[model samples]
Target: MLGVVRTLTALDRLLDVLPVLADDMRVETRFAVAEGSAFARNLADELHRCQAQVVTWDEATGKDFDLAISPSSNGPLHELEVPVVTLPHGAGHHKLRATETGVAQEVSGLSRDQLMHEGRVVPAVVGLSHPDQLAELRRNCPEAVPRAALIGDPCFARLQVSLPMREQYRESLGTGRRTLVLLASTWGRDSLFGRRGDLARELVATLPADYQVALVLHPNIWNKYDGLQIDSWTRSARRGGLILVPRLRKWQAALIAADVVVSDHGSLALYAAALGKPLLLGAFGHDEVVPGSPMELLGERARRLQPGDLRAQIDAARPVPGHRQLAELTFQDRPYQRLRTLIYQRLELPEPPWPAHPEPVDPFTP
Candidate 1:
């Protein structure tokens, strides 16, 4: 099996399922970093940490394989001869990104132009997390609908599996009894950080001693601008008791540990809501989100963060009533297992002997 990585987010999502295949002696997994995303930084380092056998994109495209899997569709997937599976790298692909020409926008992952080339579909199966996405794809890219598969979401599955470990996660973060407020942001000129970069500092300064504040930035932000730049941007906030969670690792645990999450239209918000955490949309970029996506529904129903008594807002925040609807949209209970089956089918191999149950993610560490 070959894993195609385009961004840290893609890599993060890919890592969730690769272990299922890698554990089987019958399968061999190699990683190829597709060169395109500005957020591709630190991918090599992450692959190194996993001790993954790395191959160049040139090599990946030149050679044929049993199957290729990627959580992103950004690369030249059409060039590959092998059966490719395109997976969602986030919460059900609800954002709209500009086309290559910067002239018009399409739903990020469902574009026919992105999924096909020369009047042929690229991926053998386009993996989606929900049935709603299947409908959305039909509306946006009808030609690709025949290839769509509902693979569920391994990341959200892992998050759910990690819920029982919440206290351990909190202890790791040193939040013994304090109310934890997690501020999450996606990367863009319209994200929470873009709208109010100093919100973390302001929360830290305004909230009482019984409260703990942490920031969870999207990997794109960290990579596009680098960590040194981020530290410099949040230096004062760091000094003011705001915990800047590392981009790659701690955000998951922090989300599990948080009492309330303040975020934008990022996947984290959707995940937090689905997990039944009190959520507030700190800044939502309406223009960038899909018109009728679950995220858009969330933005409509969830409370909007406002400038005021931060503590009161935190205290009064409640999980959105629409959270169950979001959860329903996510589909199955076990995603990795489903993914393993799909992969084996794609590779024309028998199922592995061992179970493919999701393991709890490691505890958060600073």
Candidate 2:
């Protein structure tokens, strides 16, 4: 049995790890989530679909579990008695330097993610994707990074193997006849397509019918801005041939099917480029308050665009050498099993049979 604490994007990371744990019936999982997060209900649905129980985290509850794993640097971790393992939540991958300017501050922010939860070190060991990330952390936050464990992102492990989502992606989103384009957007006024006159609508409005646009929105956008800015474009775009990606599973499928990617400097860009997709930057990367990321190494390969000039190429942009290198830097091969192994090693549990489900029914969801 294990406990998990998730903040915003870590819900998808939790989804990635659940498949490795699913086949093991002996291991029951419980997730502790903040009561007030926007996506709490969506997470409830997702957790039920994944067959895990949920616990509402209240600081005064003082509940203790056998082991706890948190997937975010910014989770609601407080006084807990068990050994807590903190998984990477898309930060801590670059060298750090103090700065006040936007660009340098962006670089500094990567390693120095404003140590959250009252400056309490959350994890007994911090999980990392590469040794380089560890070194970067050591130079920046020596106290924390020294306990780093090189566990590649379990999410990008799918790219290390043959894609399983190709057919389903085509089935749900489209037939394979069109050139697939993925437009992944984050939320807030800082988002890529937040107030930008609907890029998906514009893409389908401008691009020829030989293309397909799949837009996977961040869950926060789905929850917080539901009937507001998100609705402004999604319904209209769907009417105009945009394939609205619903959840992380389908989002991964879209990534598998995508030939070209348009995103901000968010996790989607990192995951897409980590899987070797041609990337283009929307307005989000160029003018955002979200700290810059090492994932931008691959994002910089593409042409940056303002909201008005969203362009499409007849042929997909070729992923450069830097894309693959940064991807390899971000992901490890066989990560699900490696994460499983690490869990067993850390928690001193017996190894469970980690088998591949050739046709996993909804994979992480019911």
Candidate 3:
């Protein structure tokens, strides 16, 4: 059995990549869950056809596995006895320290020295999106380089379901006018570091009479901001001619329907970038590590949403070029081939046939 630990942020990537492993290998894959989560249940349902086992810490104690895989860097590393592989999590901009005792590897450019300091003794592998990240990994974690493989993110291997429910939801909300989708994520209060409810109210007050706005509240915010009624807030906006969508059948579907998106530095922004949706990055608090901010990576496609800069930013964003091709390149359309081959080589399993197409380009560059 191969043990896989996953984080909610990386669930889409995991689901896309792991199914290929099941198709090619004889080993059984079981997932270790941190807690019961809606995303976990969704993942289980998605992978049910693959026959992967879902296990908790108590049930995983005596389980045997040849290798361990973690979808995010933040998952508990000490749980598995076998070698571990990790996907890049968080900013993916800075180099993390690596260690010696436990083997840690990344699909981005992180150096061995950096990895060593971060408790990752293993080398970092280059994934599809960032070749620069691979170079950094080689520079920082040289020891783990040999084991490093250049497979892309698993999420990119399979195509995401672009459902037509966006139109239905829009009609349900009566938001036929210009619409903006706000994906509000909770990075803890300290990290969220931006405007609070007052900010939302300010934006609502300032929105043009013709424009309608929808707020997709983060699932975590319900618990964090206890007793806060998203419906009431959205309804207030609705009365003002701006329609707020508090409930979504599928988050990605909502993203597809949106003309523009406002979010902080979360993975959902990446999805918006992939979909060629104009982005407005709200940099409320993460000044220390983010530097120029992840929105800078989107180049001219997005701008930082400031207190009074909303109108200008939205105006500037109107002519922004979409990068659907770039998204396809970074999130390779069929990444399972590369991932499967790399895993086989690492575990000394026989290599499988390569897919018909060559590798995709990096979406970050022209």
Candidate with best lDDT: 1
Q: Count backbone overlaps in model 3.
A: 27
TM-score of candidate 2 relative to the true fold: 0.81
Candidate 3 at residue 27, lDDT? 58
Model 3, CA-based lDDT: 0.49
Q: Residue 249 deviation, candidate 3, in Å? A: 9.5
Per-residue lDDT, model 3, residue 295, is: 33
Candidate 3 lDDT tens digits, 116-223: 435656323334234444455555455655655555544332224433345654554555666554545434442222345444555677867655665555434543
Superposed model 2: Cα runs more than 4 Å off:
35-46, 49-51, 58-64, 91-120, 162-165, 195-197, 227-229, 284-293, 305-316, 353-366
- Provide TM-scores for the models: 0.96, 0.81, 0.64
For 239-279, candidate 1 gives per-residue lDDT tens digits of 87888998675688999999999999899999999999999
**Each candidate: how many clashes?**
0, 0, 27
Which candidate do you rate higher for lDDT, 1 or 3?
Answer: 1
lDDT of 2 at 238: 75
Clashing pairs in 2: none
- For TM-score, the strongest prediction is 1
